[model samples]
Target: MPVPPATRTSPGAKAPTRPPVRRRERQIGGSQRRMADLQPGLDFTNVALRPYANVERMRNELLRCYLLSPPASEIPEAISPFTVQYISCVLATYPRCMLSDGGLPPLVHRAQVQGQEMPRALANCFSLVRMWYQAVPGSEAMVAGMVEQEMERLAGKPPGQGDYILLCTFQAYLLYSIMIYFSPLPNTSALKYKTMITLSELACRTVRNGFSCAAEHSHTRPPWETWIVAASKRRTFVTMELFRIAFNAGRLLPSSVTSELGDIFASGNRALWEASDRDSWGREHDRYLLDWEDGMLNTSELYRPEATAQKERVERWVQSVDEFGMMLFAVCAHIRGR
Candidate 1:
């Protein structure tokens, strides 16, 4: 999915609202100390959820960070590739969502699903409040505030309702945003104008804390791996899988940073297998193999022996799937209507 033209400080779009408060700077390592003393639990009782709401706001903040960040090819060696790869996942999904029409493909719709299931999966993946508190002790209050704000945004109130899936999506957005901000080198100054130093620090804190929590709880695997396991164990598992997909895709992103991007939708529901059909995603993923086998790949698009052949391939894929199919109908009725 191509990014909408109006993302950046659109003319007359509202300026970023001020955060609730700013406090005296913590000692450089205070947060780590606090995190060490925190506890881990399942309940988010009495926790405010406002900042977690306004899905659009969170999405846009991520977009600004990703699409407008420095080019990956030009990133100084001081930056870690893991961080860059993480952000790329965020940027990749927007186009994917639009193309797949928010994951309402024919095969996915055929799988009987209950509406609440998706949100439940999201909630499970993001309900790491306990881990977050303990992992980044000094930043607990601030993290809590951010969570509250997001929950309120989701609930359509000053303080929104919090859920697992929503938070997972938001986190996914964060990772993808960071990756894309540096993926390409399109006019550097125009894209790099936004200041991510603060957001980056916060992101680093959140991820590092998450890592620490995972380490304490499950010593067998890396934090990201542990997160994947936890999310999978939850009632809602799609969110974790989505993150997994993004992570895998990032590994395939070359240092060239010139891959063409477009939309490719998959299941938004947890019960459904994203690429159950061998025809679409599986085959498409496989094509990359052929591209590697032969140096004929022109950037990321398939080389057309003739442009007409390329056009036909697209048309066949599009025609095979219902543009106004049953799956899409549900999305419009349930997701869009919401």
Candidate 2:
């Protein structure tokens, strides 16, 4: 075959070649086309940003009001004004999806109307937590001073004070420790851990002493009001133990604390605790205690294969009692090694 006459080309000329189109370029083009198809008037700038500005303004107003107003003296001891304010702030700051239905407002309202008496130490703890939340200047020192005063007050009390008082003290200490541990302050991790350990130990000791007194009256059926107090003490102790185990992963804390209280061994049956009237509570108490003591329904039975069915029953019971009861079940399950 005769070679074709050389294709005409200028000196130093190169053949043209198409550049490869990248995947990213194609994607950008597709997205641009899709965006172009949408209506240009559909602007979301104000719709997205206006709520945030509104929230910021509302928060500033709330803080200003709270700071300017004189502290409320008539508020019940059982209710912490700081906690209520903190909760209100949270609700105002976040979207609805991030918030709970009511957060602690109902409890505060009840405390106000009923004139419920709260333990002094626990009240102080709430104050300390509120300070932490506010993050005011010198809050740490203020918290420390308050905690020291509380500790001294607790120390000065007679060793044989009522179980109710002692239980309150322990809970207060635990709450203080928890608040400090999770605080946003920097350079406090060591202090937080130490505080947690010390408080846990103190709580264990207090529980031992307080519950010993509670056991003496356990044999008799007390009035509905008295029984509620006793039940609260038991629940508080168990809750402390659960928190200890969870925080330390059962390594630093023992699996269980020493206690002879029957409440610890009882099923997570909330009916007994939820009885509205004295007569109903008394009746439910008897039945519940009887069921607890019955050999067939002990805590050991909760771990068996048949216990799977019981889980649903416990869940159903929790429906009537709400979150507190569910928490009880969760602690119970953990205790049973489930």
Candidate 3:
């Protein structure tokens, strides 16, 4: 044992130790593989931005459809140059949200739009409205058929041509507004969908009631235009009904879905009002009663900001069914002008 230390190492011998590292081999290969797997770019930090994004997108569509159709009287006169410019400017986010081939449609992007070289979904929307203007009677039926065609092309996938849905919805609201104004008897029975009537269907029922009333009493020669207006209103009503439910449901559904739905409803309602001939309100209302009701709705609007969150926020959204009643009343009043 005493002789071991001297014998263990010759004068130039070295102690056992790890080998020196080479410059190129500093890292273990497996670590680099794991890091690559984790970094493929799937993230969702921008969820809150979604609603605003969809609103902006739909606003553009509304503006575009409005321009394409123009007022029947003003058509062939260079579609309002200002309106086109305004919509284009307002919808600046569209390029980011535009759909691409072999990917989801515009609506499906949730937060971000991605793709390359696909036909613009907005183009389909303009075509639907243009077709509606062309078809005199059964315009609703024709538009519905066209929308179904777009739906089929998208094959139950997200971002498939849903702007058509918006068009249908807006038209329905117009119908409901008409019904509230003209019809003495409410057509509540027709409000059910497949099994249960959709909100749009309810709007249709109201508009149909108005159309019946207008046909019976108005001096307008072709009552079919009344019916067409009624049908458009009905479609819009149904859409808003669905949207109210979705918006109220909030967290129950994906935020993206609700946001888009809200955006559609807001823009659709505005468009319906703008496109309508306001001076075209047919008969005068009982002045005294009209003023009273107007005051109530105006007051309600003042409180709407406070109610917006209470009515549409996630925790309280579902409980906000009462809000729909208000919307219905307001829409009815607008159509009736009372």
Per-model TM-score on C-alpha atoms: 0.23, 0.49, 0.21
lDDT of 2 by residue, 1-338 (tens): 99889767788898667798766422211243332232223221111100011323322322332234424663212222343333233222211211232222111111111113445765565555555556566665665566556655654565455555555566566555444433435433333344554554455444443332232234435555444444455555544544444444312322232233223433334565544345666787676556434221323333322466666544444454544444545444444434
Worst 10 residues of 3 by lDDT: 44-53
Model 3 misplaced regions, further than 4 Å: 1-119, 136-144, 159-338
* Two-way TM-score contest, 1 vs 3, winner: 1
lDDT of each: 0.30, 0.42, 0.30
Model 1 lDDT per residue over 82-181, tens place:
5444434443443233232123212122111212243432332234332332445366456445543443343332212233233343343332233233
Lowest summed lDDT window (length 10), candidate 1: 257-266
Q: Pairing residues by index, what is the TM-score of model 3? A: 0.21
Instruction: List, residue by residue over 26-55, the lDDT tens digit for candidate 3.
Output: 222123323223223423221111112233
**How displaced is residue 73 in candidate 1, in Å?**
22
Pairs with steric clashes in candidate 2: none
- Candidate 2 — which residues are off by over 4 angstroms? 1-117, 148-152, 187-201, 209-221, 250-263, 267-321, 331-338
Stronger candidate by TM-score (2 vs 3): 2
Which candidate tops TM-score? Answer: 2
Error of 1 at 115 (Å): 5.3
